[model samples]
Target: MILNGITVGIILILIGLYGMIAKKHVFKIIFGLIIISTGLVLFFVSVGYVDTGAAPIVSGDTTYVDPLPHTLMLTTIVVEVCTTTLALVLALKIYEKYKTLDISTLEDL
Candidate 1:
């Protein structure tokens, strides 16, 4: 399960990298960043996973998953949302001023 999660996360990261690097539209680049953030969150969560692990509150001989990664990911998600929103707002403002979202066209203008 952990391996599967890691694989998916890596795939998402790759897709996001491609989107960011290959796409010319501002919104697409913003979406790529969002995807990368999501992939990072998934990767961290998978890294913290422990087989047969229980929450720290449980009193047993079972392994306990570290809560730090999960906590950090939660904070990351909040930050990602804020960053994405800001990026989108900036994109919108750019579009309103330039009337285009294409990076090349914007550059030429």
Candidate 2:
């Protein structure tokens, strides 16, 4: 199950990368970045997952899943939300100024 999650994450990352590279719209690129972030979070969580593991609390004779990744992902998700909001705000400003969301048109202007 963990491996499956990892694989799905990798695939999502790749798809996001392709969108960022091949898409012509700024919104699409922003969406791609969001997708990449999601994939990374998924991969990170999966990496720290342990089969039949208990919570990372102090306990005797209990296997604990690593908490570092979960902690990092929490921070990452906060940053991602901020970043996405900023990107969307910037995109809105760009649209207001240029009246278009197309990268090619923006370049021509």
Candidate 3:
């Protein structure tokens, strides 16, 4: 059920969006960003699907899955990980600044 995967990705993306929009906590925003990145990665990886595709290696049999998108997805994931780390660092900075991770609390600072 490929459609099921799509639906799940969509749900995750929506939940992430809601968290990003509704939550006032800096930590939750970072997690929401991770969720959204995961959804996007899932969607991009799905595009390289083939019902009877083989691995990216040069096997004796042909019909290999496209390697381009998968490689790009890998790069994207690396960037996401770096972004997550940076977000965590920013959250830490926020905590140090206001003594609380809540965005609303930072308004007084």
- Give one digit per residue, the lDDT tens place, for model 3 in 17-36: 99898899998998898999
Q: Against the hidden true structure, what lDDT does model 1 obtain?
A: 0.90
Model 2, position 78, has a per-residue lDDT of 96
Give the 10-residue window scoring lowest on summed lDDT in candidate 2: 1-10
Q: Which TM-score value belongs to model 2?
A: 0.89
Candidate with the larger TM-score of 1 and 2? 2
Off by over 4 Å in 1: 1-3, 59-61
Report every candidate's CA lDDT. 0.90, 0.92, 0.83
Cα error, residue 62 of model 1, in Å, equals: 3.0
Taking all chains together, each candidate's TM-score versus the true structure is: 0.88, 0.89, 0.86
Q: For every candidate structure, what is the RMSD over all alpha carbons to the true structure, in angstroms?
A: 1.9, 1.8, 1.7
* TM-score-based ranking: 2, 1, 3
For model 2, residues 1-109, the per-residue Cα lDDT tens digits are 4558789889899999999999999999999999999999998987888989988897799888889999999999999899999999999999999899999989899
What tens digits encode model 1's per-residue C-alpha lDDT throughout 8-90? Answer: 89999999999999999999999899999989989898888788888756685778987888999989999999999999999
TM-score of 3: 0.86
| Better structure of 1 and 3 per TM-score | 1
Which scores higher on lDDT, 1 or 3? Answer: 1
The worst-scoring run of ten residues by lDDT in candidate 1 lies at 53-62
Clashing pairs in 1: none
